[model samples]
Target: MSAILEVENLRVAYPSRQGPVEVVRGVSFALGRERLGIVGESGSGKSQTGRAILGLTAAGGRVTADRLHFDGIDLRGASPRIWRQLRGRRMSMVMQDPKFSLNPVMTIGRQIVEAGRRGGVSRRDAKARALEMLEAVQIRDPGRVFDAYPHELSGGMGQRAMIAMMLVGRPDLLIADEPTSALDVTVQLEVLGILDDLVRDRGMGLVFISHDLRLVSTFCDRVLVMYAGRVVEEIAAADLDRATHPYTRGLLNCLPRIDAEARPLPTLERDADWAR
Candidate 1:
């Protein structure tokens, strides 16, 4: 399969009073038209990695890499023009928190319609396409949601609307940061089905970032276990139990198993050496 994204020694840092603080340190991965999951704890830099991939790193953050290429296009110090040309049309990201990502002032429909328009969708068809995407994300009432403001919708509804917005353009590479985190189990499955179909049918390359290791194992083809701004292990999703890294093993052991009974749930023990 053709590689859609490439990264080598990718790093993201921010300026502080003392000096530069690196959040993502020398991370590297390549992506194809398949599902790849990155799993780690909250501060493990999982979300930062996804944001860096899409050139959405925070304003003060500095992103650098020996090689960061997307579909043969070099993304190092990519201009705003280049980002605008690629984002929403050929590439998109479903951010983890819709409350911060979505515009509070705009109606859900207008936001989604704008995304479609970015891909050159005609004004006449944009609304129809927007509504279709909302329904695709398992929203029960697309019509009502279309007119609702971001604050008017519940957390789950806002998340679905964000998903709808990102998918409106049918991007080739989708970097999803906990896309289904806010939804119920049933809706989570529906969203997963949509992503799976996009990978299988539309040939979309997906980078899934989540904290749920079990969910990643079932949905992704491969998994990257990150710890302290670095990937500690890379393994096939089906073979997670056989992971060699101690951090990965510790994480797995910490999970509660219905099959096995443990009076106290184990907590992850960290190793300072793992950061190196």
Candidate 2:
């Protein structure tokens, strides 16, 4: 399959009194129209890598790449105009926290409808699509939730609304950051089903960033294990157990097992060289 997103020697650094602090250190990968999961602990630069792809890096951060291309568009020097045209229409990101992704004052309906409109849907169609998305995310009383503001809903409810908003538009590439973290198992399965259908049927490329190792291993076609802003291992989802990297083996060993005798789970031993 052709690549939908490409990154080579991608680096993200922020200016600081101490000097430039590199958050993403020379990460590289390619994504096709399939699920690609990035798994790591907090502060592992998974979120920052996704943000850089969407041109949403924080202020004063510097992003440089030998090549960062998305469907033939070079993202290294892309202007605001280019981003405005591409984001939502061709690509969209579902942020981990709805509070950060959604407009607190705007009703969910308006936000989702706006996303649909940005994808070139008519106002009437946009409204319909927005409501359909709300229902798809397993929100009961879609109408009521649609009219509610971000702060009015619970964490999980608001997250579902945000997912609804992001999926309202037909994006070729989607970067989902811990999207199902706030959702229940049932709802998580439902949402994953939707994502699966999008990839299988609509041929949408997905970059699924999460801390859930089991979920990624099952859902993603391939997996990238990151540590301290760099990829420690890249392995097929099915072959995760065969991963040779010490970091990957350590992480797998740490997982709680049901069949095993009750005992304290082994913690990953840190290696300074893994971050270098």
Candidate 3:
């Protein structure tokens, strides 16, 4: 498949008392209609890179890049008007927590309908399409789910509903940030399965960002390991065990194994140079 998104020499920084605190430094990557995983610890700037691509950085943060393109359109410093045009229709983001992402007072059905309406669907058509998406995400009672409020649903249900809403726009690219981190293990796997199915069925490009190395390897096609705002390693998901970077190796060593003998959990050793 051709490249759907591309980033080159991308940098994001925030102003501080002393000077600029850079989060992402010269990050570069290209994504096709396949799954790509970004794995890193807290404060590694993995999520910042994703937001920068979507033109959704924090107020004080600044993003600079030589090239940021989506389907041959340059996105570097693109106007807000263009972003609004593409965001919900051609591209969408699935945030980690639905409780915060979804409107508290809006009906689930109404929210999904609003999402569909961004693509110019009529209200009736939007509602019907929303119901269809709820079913696509494996919600058994689409009508009930549509009528309920975000607060009335469980965590898993809400997340699935959010997924359904995100897909209602039929976006070509979906950026999922720690999408299943708050769910139980069983629910997490189920949600991941739903994402995989969507990617396969719709040919949508996926950027799965999370801290769990094992989960990313299992759920994604390729993995990019981040350390101190920089991509330290890139490896195939199936070959993540053989990662050459010290940081990647440390992350692998730290994961608990089902068959391993009981022992002290390993910790990642950090060096000052890793921040550079």
Candidate 4:
């Protein structure tokens, strides 16, 4: 598959009282029409990398890259207008939680329709597309959900609605930041299955960012292990157990196995050099 997104030496910094602090330092990766998982501990800059790609960083944050391209478009130099045209149209994001991401006042269907409209679809057509997307995400009753507000839905339903809204535009690339982290194991698997099917059927690229090493290994094609704002290792998901990097091994070892003997869980030992 051809590359859908590319980044080289990407950096994101913020001005601090102590001077400039780099949250994402020299991160680089390429994504294709396949599921790519970014796994790391919290504050490791995994989310920042995704946000920088979408140009959604905070006002005080500065993002710079030697090369940042999306479908051959130079994202590093993209104007605000260009970004507006691209974001939610050619590319979209499914954030961690729907309660915070969704508009509490708007009906779920209306939000999905608005997203479709942003991609240049008419209101009438967008509404139809919204219902279709809701159903595509496996919502049993699309009509009922269409009229429901974000606050009226359960966690899983709200997440499915959020997915519907994001995918309504039929974006080429989807950045899902720990999208299933807030759900139960059963719901998490269900959501993962939905995402898997959509990516396969739509031929869209996915950037699945999460700290769940086991989940990512099974659900994604490749995995990028990050530490201290940098990619410490990149390995095929199938070969995750064979990862050589200490950070990756540490993460994998932290996962409790069902067959393991009863013993205290191993604690991850961090090396300061990994952050350098």
- Pull out the clashing pairs in model 2: none
Misplaced by over 4 Å in model 1 are none
103-159 per-residue lDDT for model 3 (tens digits): 999999999898899956899999989998898776789999999999999988898
lDDT of 3: 0.88
TM-score per prediction, in order, is 0.98, 0.98, 0.94, 0.94
What order do candidates take by TM-score, descending? 2, 1, 4, 3
For model 4, the run of ten residues with the poorest summed lDDT: 181-190
Misplaced by over 4 Å in model 3 are 185-187
User: Candidate 4: lDDT over CA atoms?
Assistant: 0.90
Q: Each candidate's lDDT (Cα)?
A: 0.92, 0.92, 0.88, 0.90
- How does model 1 fare in lDDT? 0.92
| Cα misplacement distance, residue 134 of candidate 4 (Å) | 1.8
Runs in model 2 deviating more than 4 A are: none
Query: Model 2, range 1-276, lDDT digits (tens) per residue?
Result: 999999999899999999999999999999999999999889999999999999999999999999999999999899899999999888999999998889888898999889899845799999999999999999989999988888899999988998888888979999999999999999999999999999999999999999888999999999999999999899999998889999989888888888886366587889899999
Clashes of 3: 0
